[model samples]
Target chain A: MSEGSQGLLLAGVGGQGVILASMIVADALMRAGHDVKQSEVHGMAQRGGSVFSHIRWGERVDSPLVPLGSAEVLAAFEWAEAVRWVEYVRDGGAVVADVRTIVPPGACNDHRSWLRRYPGIDGELFDSRHLKTRLIDATATAEELGNVRAANSVILGTVAAFIDIDNKHWEAAIAHLVPKGTEEINLAAFRIGRDVAEARVPQTAPDPEGFSGPHQIEINHVWCKGCDICSRVCPEYCLAVDVDGKLTIIDAEACTGCKLCEALCPDFAIEISAPREPAVVGNQAAADGSTL
Target chain B: MTDVKTYLREWAMPHVLCPGCAHGIVLRSFLNAVDQLQIDQDKLAMVAGIGCSSRLVGYVDFCTLHGTHGRAPAFATGLKLARPDLKVVVVTGDGDALAIGGNHLIHAARRNIDITVLLLNNSIYGMTGGQAAPTTPEGALASTTPAGNTEPNFDACKLLMGAGASFVARVLAANPMDMTKVMADGLDHPGFSFIEVISDCPEYFGRYNKVGGGAEMLTWMSVRDEGVAGPLAEKRFVNHIPIESVPSGMETGVLQREIRPVYAGVRKVEDHES
Candidate 1:
């Protein structure tokens, strides 16, 4: 590592202005009489994918990439991204993160439980790393300033507090880089963000009630005409008709309570009963809880 | 959520519909909509005329009235006017609503009364031994039209929309969730809500047309969906039915919704001003 060089990382969802914020940081660093190099990945920006940028500044900056556990600070625009990029920050470094959550498409695999695969706001996770964490609702602050799009400026303002750069440099870069006519709100958002307090971290949400286990599938043999409709419509392939023209439960435990078979059955012979216990206990809990 | 079975008359289990019939699915979706709306069973009324679709009213635990053939809409209109507090729903088959009771159905829609009409169009009179119904696609084989009927089929949703129905929608039995959603919207509508459910009769229509069983019929119905309704210029399948007479694609979703004064009863002089 260089004697006087410092690295910073910014992480967020694709459309959260991660690249623009990185550019502003680099510009401000240059204005502070330091050589700066910045690199970013926004290939999946339009698809709501992860976006991140690395900025390094010093007397003579070389590599724009911030090595693992070497960054001085980490700025994250979303909650999940904060946890994702927190490892890059060195011990005792600072983390500026917005408490906003943006759930990706892949996390919506289990529609039956209706529980999002998202991490809760837990400060203990950062405490384990011995890092300073500042969680703020930048979007709400920017929204109060009249435009929600100025949220990135608010985040940049908090990030500015951690860097040893002058306020004039940040305001100049923000005013010069942001879209025309949005300068006032963005500057106001930055000013408010500089003095913003730590937001109240909400407690971990409890598992939703009523969905305890696999739904109970009951079939009335007398009413079921073995028409093959219910068996074919079952997404989980839980029901199947035998050669003798009788409905049977082939995979009872796989039922997700989608109710497709129950709703499509022609004879009203199938009924799905909700599970009596909570499905969130033990091994069946969402993977996000244990991974974080 | 309350069990949908609670809304049904358990003794009426094993409905009289033929094997592989889609009416049962429509019934289940309707019950789901009713359950979602949380309408009190005692305060809801199910009116039906004589047909396979009409038989659905008899199985529900709500206040039901099985009227004469093709007169379900007339009965529903009277019941709604007499008891404005009750949520009245008329379940009728294509043959019952579009043919036998077509006049009453059109008049009820024209008047914009507060009632929901679910016209289950199976394209044949399944209860009457597979006779050709008014909604039977041209060139389709029915017991009465073995030589392929020369008469054209009726687009039930278009007819209702043209008759000034405040809310009009068409849903396929293949998509039960979408069917339930549209049914819920119709039930919540204020005046003259008409929903045409494209159901299948595996024993009758499917067998006569060689359209396979219930599963195949459902797939075929799904393929006919012309996407959600939009502006007339943006519609891909503008013509109701293609010239090939094979029952071309049709728009499925809320086709029209208008806020019109509902016909409650004889309006007073001051009522017109309001």
Candidate 2:
């Protein structure tokens, strides 16, 4: 695991499955056993307004909301939205943006004219029409996979390729989160995305001083409701309840604080806290998603 | 009851709520009702209007509809009609339900849809800087009503009963015991059931009315009577004269002994409309 935290922002208009895509990424990270917290804003969504999600995954996450200007990955379904949140990405952060610009209302008399003002924004902008970008088009891929409604799954697959998480862990998380009868298509989309990200992302030298030291806990009793939801959705089966009805952490090392258990609990009796406190520092990274 | 601590998301959950806000109490009571009845988790649908109280839907994990201001009844109506198996509950503030959505409430009660309406009447609109609401007391001062409000307020339970609601009751948010009981009973009612909860808006209504703090607001509610009325009472008004007068044809009492035939019956005639 990296020593520092990783922040990702998912931005798009409502109904573009931005929330679902954000969930998929967060789910994959949790499966890899990384600490994560995600915050979603969706009020007045019926009016077709802009929507954004903040995801912080790594060592530990406290506040679900990330402070401005700390995103390492900014994935946008639309081009203008990508520019809108371009300032959040830290220097050297990766941005995998879609270039299929759908002009928002009041941008201009025409949509194309409205889109011309965006290239000036920073970061490596990938044309959404790029062959690699096909994985980002989950809506199209869902249809190809025999269900037009599974488009959000496609974008998740595209995002899988960029982060440092493992692919099998993500596959297992998808298998857990998604409904049955649609696993094959989602896995295919995810594999394609991994291949693309591996091809495009440059390999960085690993930090010798990665996360280390006394950051672990021994929870005596975990009163999980025996609902297979956690076991099903977890990429790592770190969660288990012994015969005595106490929940057990099978692999404490692999329990990411994604708080998916908190989100999905029907009875609502699970708690997960970050193992370590996070520190903030000043950096001169360009506001755009780049390594300038 | 599901322990609130366990159900809540651990993230610094938004502390947007003001101290001693009635919306929180209303939300707690609501959760209690659902827990006590053991309502099928998947079958519970909540509809909310726009107000401090309406925002209650945001924190909850159920299938919630944060519809437009004052249109929760209309939305809940459509939701219940489409999915008859689902138990729909509408939570609205006084302003949202009586002022802007008065017509929807009247029609829903008149049609008697199998929906439960939790009307949180704090007598002021807390979300929009504490303005005068339809239920604001005749002489109560508000942000909009500098001197005092001159308009009469609607008695939600009485209005619903007169509009043909099958079940009606009123309780104060201060009395969690009775409030939870009334909520459960309303949800169990087979037709449009109206339960008006006298909630305390400590931030706006309380400070403006000089009712002290949230605890003081609850104290005010504790002294009030449950205004129970008889069935054939010739003109039982919601308000008493001398101190102040507001015209409300609703008397405090149960209206119907049994649930009358409603839209569901009409649907039955048509073999159920989807």
Candidate 3:
């Protein structure tokens, strides 16, 4: 996966639809012929605490979680929380923050007033662009859309246009997730955000399918134990052991495409293969028991 | 004896649980019920609390969740609320249910949400090395109750029945035959069904009580109440052992009542204004 296609993070205080926004991005990625993994912290969010969701996608994804400092873009629904999760973004990554600061339970009697004077949060720690932040009046946009509930969806639209994901995939995902009767307001919110994001970064290019990122696994053969334990642990059983118990990957085609073997290999002797479009069944084997 | 191997998740190893523990029996009965019902395997959510009995989900397939101690009821409650169409089952031991999760269980029954709660009762706590539990017999010896347990045990069936559970019953794990029926009935019944399995904790309860072994314990349980030993017995029996052999309706277990409060205590607020 390309650094741009590892996907984005969505963060906010409670009640904001950070989870829903992440889901929307995941669905869009899926529709664009990429594998996507989305994870959210559920039970704790209702108590008025910061909420964040990790959205990771690629031609292939090994885990739902994104390691910190890998997010290509961040859609921060709250100012303070934006600062809190800014570390998720990579250096030079973009942040589309909603300027409306929500008062966490004990901030002050006049949190709204304090927020107006709440000097901007720094973004350099994650190597992200500080001055390039897009301040969106998402609440105001939702109000104009006739319902404040559509704010997250509006923010997602802006995120879509800023990232490489296709706008149609985002729209399709909205259609799939939203309840039967609430399509119009959601689509409207999506359009508002998409337009905002597009307006901010006019030169950004849309991400194409099968984009490869710089992250790659390197093998050190000198450290190899040759115990063949990695072959025994492979879930896809992609490993083959010879009479001497030396390990070798057999029919890498049989690999369910999970890197568990590589990750768990005792001797860091297994390396990641070059980026190639994952093969569909037709070319690999015949329909019946016979090999192609 | 239902084979648990077929229903268990392929990767789940039988590494946990104690020997002669009734948790295995309850878990087997639950898997049998799911199999018989032809439930959508993917949609079945099994939530568990902390205890020897609660660890049973590690051996089951489907979406198994191991939550905090005594919080399976609350966690299952939230899961059921979020996805009403899914079949949600909460499995917890006596300590997990009666001690820490008592409020959540009672409120869950009061609400009568469409969920099943299988409460495994082994007289004493087995996970933390057999301390005196709420369901421990008054004279039972435990690690914490060196002399003997002074307090009375809580009849969980009575509590749930009083709280308006649509279905409530109790069965013993020694009687695998009856356990299958009881568990099946609990899973099929709508609203909140509370089924308490009088499970065994041989390493703890047996050694403390000097009950030779699980077989001896089963024999003792079988012979305790022979007065109700009749055809189509008016009382519940496990493995033909009348564990709770008192007359129906007069007993604490085997209760079926009308629905009351449901999920998260969120009644149909006339408007969405709450």
Candidate 4:
């Protein structure tokens, strides 16, 4: 009930694990001895639709709702969703948003060519003078790391770093809350997010192409969702993900040009080019596409 | 794990269902039935309304869809009529099917449309913080009914049969094998098949009424005898019809399997009789 209590809002499209991530955060906060109150909305129009969770924590909390313009944190799962709900962030509050953009189907319902008329989303929507922002390409990062679904965990990690909670409690909550077999990956994502926040570094995974061989695979950085399936399934052990979570070819020659990476990519970002003469490493000049 | 993984959308695992919610059990049982039946995933259409149980459609990797709250039957009816080739199945929770959807439920059965409806009856409105629902046991405690639910609750299986469904069965979440068997029977039935999954809502209903958590409720359900649908079981459930008229001996496994003409895509006898 205190005026200076902590309040956070988690917003994302449905099937994005909004409720689960919020629950994990609530658990961590409650274990840290803070009174936590959480409210959520679940229903029929959820699949691919907008969803949100409201969490409040402090010495003593009253209502679960954070009231307009009073939240300390606005953790969003997509870039556009951050813009849609950035109004709730209190002055000086931080917005931790995933850089992915998901345009609702209704927005483009009428016209197949609406993008030409409307152009694209503004990348600087959350860059207001008053509000602090930490945007992460969590989907790409998690996917590139082997699981695009870990974006929620990665975002939670990033959010946890900005908050005052200790690492021990967060770990405990994640271990208890996350389903079996995903603890390590989620924990790694949490740590990566924490490191990004603590270091205040812009995420840029060093060029994925480390070593070159007779066969070359170029990954369009913009299009990759960063689910690490390619790296995990790669027989060559030549692929490695960078800190930025954009996939990079760590060992090029090690790749047998198996085309497995290209086959497994959900985003179709990997292109296996038959042994190029000059193996161009990092700094993808032709990398700008829809993948980002 | 392999068996379920084939049916489940694994990415959506550790579903939104609460810790002790029995909806998960019923969901697994249904999927097991699908696996046992060797159903072609592409030829199957899964429809659901709003509730915890309805969300099961999301996890099933099939031609699954979600309709508006309490309108799944109508949507399923439309799907069945238009694309009779698809094996249409409807999943709904207590509030969704019985309260707002009571109209569609009766009509779907009356028409004998070929659709399998798995009504997960958790007594209270589990999604809406446990308000009293049409299927909540009379005198049962709920958040809305502080003093206890005063109104009677309808037995969905009986009501579906009374509405002229060709196949009807009542099973519990605690008994997965029986639930799966009955579910398979319902699915294989030519006409409208209705299976009532007596579910548990430990968070809202149990916490309010002091019954117990999900495990305890499952234990209670497990010990109860099946196939003994005599006056004792009849007394527990509420029906609009008289007790004398209500059939005793609801033989549990598959209560009804009558050979009736299906309504959908069926020609009238008078039109073809020579």
Candidate DockQ scores, in order: 0.38, 0.01, 0.02, 0.01
Per-residue CA lDDT of model 4 for A109-133, tens digit only, reads 3222333332233435445536677
Off by over 4 Å in 3: A1-292, B1-4, B224-253, B257-274
Q: For all candidates listed, what's the TM-score of chain B alone?
A: 0.90, 0.84, 0.83, 0.86
Q: For residues B93-201, write the lDDT of model 2, one tens digit per residue.
A: 8989998999999999999898889888889988889899888878887999989899887777767778888788887665565677778888877778898888767
Span of 10 residues, lowest total lDDT, candidate 1 chain A: A283-292
Sort by TM-score, best first. 1, 4, 2, 3
lDDT of each: 0.84, 0.64, 0.67, 0.73
lDDT of 1 by residue, A54-137 (tens): 999999977899999989999999888998888899998999998777766555334343344556666777898888878888
Specify the highest-TM-score model's number: 1
TM-score of each: 0.76, 0.43, 0.43, 0.44
Please report the candidate that would top DockQ against the real structure. 1
lDDT of 4 at B227: 42
Candidate 2: CAPRI quality band = incorrect
**Which candidate number maximizes lDDT?**
1
Question: Per-residue lDDT for B89-140 in model 1, tens only?
Answer: 9999999999999999999999999899999999999987999989888899
lDDT tens readout by residue for model 4, B208-259: 8665665445533433433432333342212222334222222356778776
Clashing pairs in 2: A92-A290, A138-A151, A138-A154, A139-A151, A222-A247, A268-B6
- Candidate 3, residues A1-292, lDDT tens digits: the string is 4443486788987888888777778888889888888888766678778888888888778777777877778888876777777777777777777766665544432222333333343334333354246657688789898989888988887777666766788889999987687789999988878777322211111111222221133434444445443554454456766786455656554444345444333223465553455322121221232310
| Superposition TM-score, candidate 4 onto the true structure | 0.44
